[model samples]
Target: MDMTIDAIDARVVPPVALAYTKALTLPHLASAVRPRFLVLQPNGSLNQANSSDFQHGLESILEQATDGVIVDLLWVGSLDAYGIAALVAGIQRATALGKQMLFQALDAKSRLALEIEWAQQQESSVGAWKHTFSSNLEAFLDNFTHG
Candidate 1:
């Protein structure tokens, strides 16, 4: 099936809320075809400070999603030790259900740091997770749309 991903920039509360609203409004966004996957880009906003709230939002979306519809998440933010633990916990939960969850850092330095931390805390298999570091949104969109 052809994949359609709605790339949402959840940088603020309103946009985060709007992302969820837009997912629910999928029927109106396109004609005939419903989205095969929902890829969430919780950039900068998803952090240890707001882990609980972020998890709640994700859970809500998961609960509402149709069966077989994949929820692919990329969480990016400045994470403290505790926040990183929380993020890992969330990733584990998603993995248990066979969901596609990625923990990405927006910067190269942060990405390297996260990779080391993830390797140390490797609760799951090495291939079970993935990471990405890029600031270019348009390039991502073009590749995503074409591929």
Candidate 2:
């Protein structure tokens, strides 16, 4: 059965047409992998204000993707706990739908933020888990190849 990107999820507002229109305004990052791969490079800080856009962009892209999505943090300068949580939620959402959500090329700061937030989540005994967060895109892709 063929599904439109906007039609993939029923809960989100603004539907496919509006979502696609909004997505066009966001950054279109290059994906090292071809076909069904959606790479998003969010610049500057990823906080509450920007995370909605990031999340929406991710959801919109996921609607259209067949394989999975990749969020490259190479250009992200800072990410807060909320931002990390948002990413975790997005990854969970993707995984629930049987798609991969890969986070790649994390900078030192982003890496630290993810570790700190992840540790906090573990300590609290709750929160989403990512099976695929890597230092590089090649490594992220290699998992599928090796498996």
Candidate 3:
């Protein structure tokens, strides 16, 4: 398994960016070249309309991904309340499906607050998921190489 970090625009939902990144990674996927980790960094202000589209797009992309591929996604930025909710849901769903999800709260205190609230709502169900907080890309790389 290989590893690749997808540093996305902070504002975009992780899923949406995942979809786009997957497209760029199609050749690898088709060849069964499993990547141990995929880090996503959405921009600080991903457009609302794009978020919805990205969710649907990501779902479609996942359908084509190889089973048992461990994906580690990271969201970095200060987002709006609604944006944070969308991101949380996206991450939760990915985790439920066996992806490792991580969130890096840059400087958006309000957005981080909302993320915590949303996480609390799904606490019981999301416990099996792996979550982390950090801005260190090297750490992710280390896991990626080992995996």
Identify the leading candidate in terms of lDDT: 2
- Candidates in order, TM-scores: namely 0.42, 0.54, 0.46
Candidate 2 lDDT over 1-147, as tens digits, reads 011122222244443332223233433324532235555556667788777767766775765566777776766777777788778767667877788887778767766777776577565766656676556876768877897
- Tell me the tens digit of each residue's lDDT in model 3 across 31-127: 4444344443443343464555444534433444433222232343334555555556666666667754444444557546656866686776656
State model 1's lDDT: 0.46
- Superposed Cα RMSD, model 1: 14.9
Flag regions of model 3 displaced more than 4 Å.
1-28, 57-78, 108-111, 123-147
Give candidate 2 regions above 4 Å deviation. Answer: 1-34, 112-147
Residue 93, candidate 2: how far off, in angstroms? Answer: 0.9
Q: How many steric overlaps are in each model, in order?
A: 0, 1, 11
Ranking by TM-score: 2, 3, 1
> Across residues 1-147, which tens digit of lDDT does each residue of candidate 1 receive?
111235333333332222444223333333223232345445444455666655554554443333212333334435555445555555555656665555433466555655666667673565545465565976898789999
lDDT of 2 at 98: 86
Indicate the residue-level lDDT of 22 in model 2.
Answer: 26
48: Cα error in model 3, Å: 2.8
Global Cα RMSD, each model: 14.9, 13.9, 14.4
